[model samples]
Target: MLVVTTACNLDCAYCYEGGGNGQGEMMDLDTALRALDLVAASNQPFHVQLTGGEPLLAGELVFRILEYIRNNNLPATTAIQTNGVLLDHQTARRLHSFGTAVGVSVDGLPAIQEQLRGQGAATWKALAMLDSERVPFSVTTVLSSRNTRDLSTLGMALHSMPAASAIGLDLLVQKGSAAAKIGVQPPDAVTIRSGVTRLLATLDVLNAQRSRPLILRERQTVLKALGRDEARPYCQACTGSSLAVTPRGELYPCTQTLGDARFHLGTLDHPRLSGTALPDGRLPKREECAGCGLQGRCPGDCPSRLHYNGADGAGLVCALYRTICDYCLYKGEIPS
Candidate 1:
């Protein structure tokens, strides 16, 4: 994940990047190029994720990176995670032309979005623009007390967007603005289980009726676990397979662990990226998770989340996965 810039245009209530108030630095062209070189040296199929406070905020830099990837024919698949408020027609066209997959952060339905991220109308318009341009994209919602009850409704809304191929539910990490006294929090285990149940049911029915199914990212993980597939790394950061570069070219295991010294590999000029050890140099094992039915099938929660929420964090995710796996067993027909 290349954090093109720490600056962002939005002040989301749950922004883990310290509200991305545009006070952060931007990545210069040299830093971005060096990061790409590191990626190329891996000699494996790589996924370059361009992210930031809002990557489009540094539009010129983003385009330059994209152009570099294209001109050099780098062996990499690219994507950009944006809030979608700045996804105008021209920006959308440029992104599509570059074959860059897009992931938009939207809390939920308009009202819920407005309450959390603000600029509900702008984000909605961006989704419409993506659909109009036929740009395939996915929606990522930060599940919290604020939007847990409306997961099904959010699914239904995304169901109408032809270009929306999936919805990824990310638990609220209690850091940055979310760590504030009045900040958003992850829903309780019960709320997550219930919300996930409704969401799975909604997606099951929706998939049964559509030629192109809207995938629930977490549900897919549950399905893979149920099938007893070999457990893959929870994320690039989990196994230290990917390096996240900050605006100033500092490197970490992944985007979520950007600032912590423990996860810091080194700077772009003197990278310390090596080995397969996790960012913390240890696999997170929880006593509570011992002997759970999901066990190895579930790769576990994000380390950064576990760090923020401690042992308590696992329960919420555990409830979610267990509900999905149990639901599939009960239905006897896992929805595609």
Candidate 2:
């Protein structure tokens, strides 16, 4: 992942980047190119995710990087993670032309969106623009105490967008503005389980009516883990296969660990692509999870969140995965 810039246009209540206010650094063309070269050196099929406080804030730099990928014929699949407020018609067209996958951060309906992201109408407009331009995109919602009850409503709204292909539920991380704020806390386990249960039922009904099903990112992960012989790491960062490059060319295991000198790998000038030596690089065995029914069936939670929330983090993850896996078993969605 490449954090093109930390300058965000919105002051989201739970922004993990600490509510960026357009006063952060932007990546230079040379640094971005060098980062791409570093990834290419791995000699592996890799995915490049262009993310930021709001990547569209640096529109020119983003387009240039996309152009570089195409012109060089780099062996990489690219995507952009945006807040969707700046995804106007021209931006949507440009993204379509580049054939880059787009993931938009939108918390739920208009009211919830306004409360969390401080922009609702613009996100709706961006969704319309993406649909109009035939840009298939996914929605990522930061599940928090604020919007846990509204998951079903969000699912219905997303079903209306023809270009919407998936919905990814990101449990709120206790960092940034979220940690400083009073009301912005991760939802309790019961709220998550109930909210996700309703969401799963809603999606089931929605998928039955549509020719192309709307994928649930968490459910997909659980399904894959269930089919595997043993549990796999939750994300590429756990195995040290992924790196997040900041605008200043600093590298970390992933975006969530972008700062924190402990996880910092190195700078673009002198790269240190060590595997699993970083603090959160390797997945640690949790004694608390031993002998749990869902132990092996679960892929585990985010290392960054675990590091931040400690024991409470594991409880949240267990609630989420257990709810989804139990729902699937009850519905016979997969063999028990």
Candidate 3:
């Protein structure tokens, strides 16, 4: 993943890298090129997701990378993940020409959104611009303690947004300063199970009603995982699949590992891509899970959440994942 810049215009409470204090921190252009060259040299197909506090914050860098990819005919799929607040009409047009699929962040209506993103309606306007430009985009709603219970309401709201081609629900992993101060974290296991069920049912209604229905990533993900060849539950080990590039050209296993120097993979100029040495602390380590039949289907919980705040909160959500997995495995009740 190319982290163009760590600066974001919005003061979202759950920002993983704190906030715009990282405004000036940007990945050097040469570092970006080197990263791409290394990937292309492998002669393999891959995806380079441009992400940051907001990639659009560094529009020039984003454009340069896209142009380079096209000119070189790199065998890679490129996309950007942005907050959508700065995605103006012209910017949207430029991205469209580059064949970039945008994934924007949108929690809910103004009241709910402002709670985490501060007092602003810029995101709403950006969403409108995306629709006006007919930009192909999707929404990522970060579920927090504040909005978990009302996911069904959020589902209905997203359904009404023509710009949203899908909704990807992300449970907050309290890591950075901004995220830790979000006031409420994710709810307990039982509550999450109930809330997600409601959200899934609401999506079912939308799928039945709309001709080009927005996709439910949660539902789709669960379905795909269940059908996979792995007999055990799978946790997307961040180090194995991808790495996040820092502004200084430093590499880390994932964005969640930012600020923690322990996981540094080395620099782009002197690259050392370590995929196998990541510690178990970065994964679910509950000893009791060893003999459980469900271990293959639902590991413990997200490691990012477990050690985020210098606390072990993974058990809270681990129980939740277990409950949901049980229903899916035994009851045959998929997320949708």
Best by lDDT: 2
Model 2 residue pairs with clashes: none
Tens-place lDDT digits, model 3, residues 1-336: 888888777777767776565456777789899889877888988788898877887889999999999999998888998877777888999999988998888787767778877534777778777877888788888777777778778778767666668877766777665455647566666677787777767877786877678787655555554564443323344336567788888887677787677777788777678551343333355764575434555433344455564433666555445544554556575433
Top model number, TM-score: 2
Model 2 C-alpha lDDT per residue in residues 255-280, reported as the tens digit of each score: 88767777788888877876433343
Two-way lDDT contest, 2 vs 3, winner: 2
TM-score of each: 0.93, 0.94, 0.85
For candidate 3, report its TM-score.
0.85
- lDDT of candidate 1? 0.82
How accurate locally, in lDDT, is each candidate? 0.82, 0.83, 0.71
Flag regions of model 1 displaced more than 4 Å.
Answer: 229-232, 279-293, 334-336
Which segments of model 2 are wrong by more than 4 Å?
275-293
Please give the ranking of all candidate structures by TM-score, highest first, separated by commas. 2, 1, 3
Candidate 1 TM-score, C-alpha based? 0.93
Model 1 vs truth, CA RMSD = 2.5
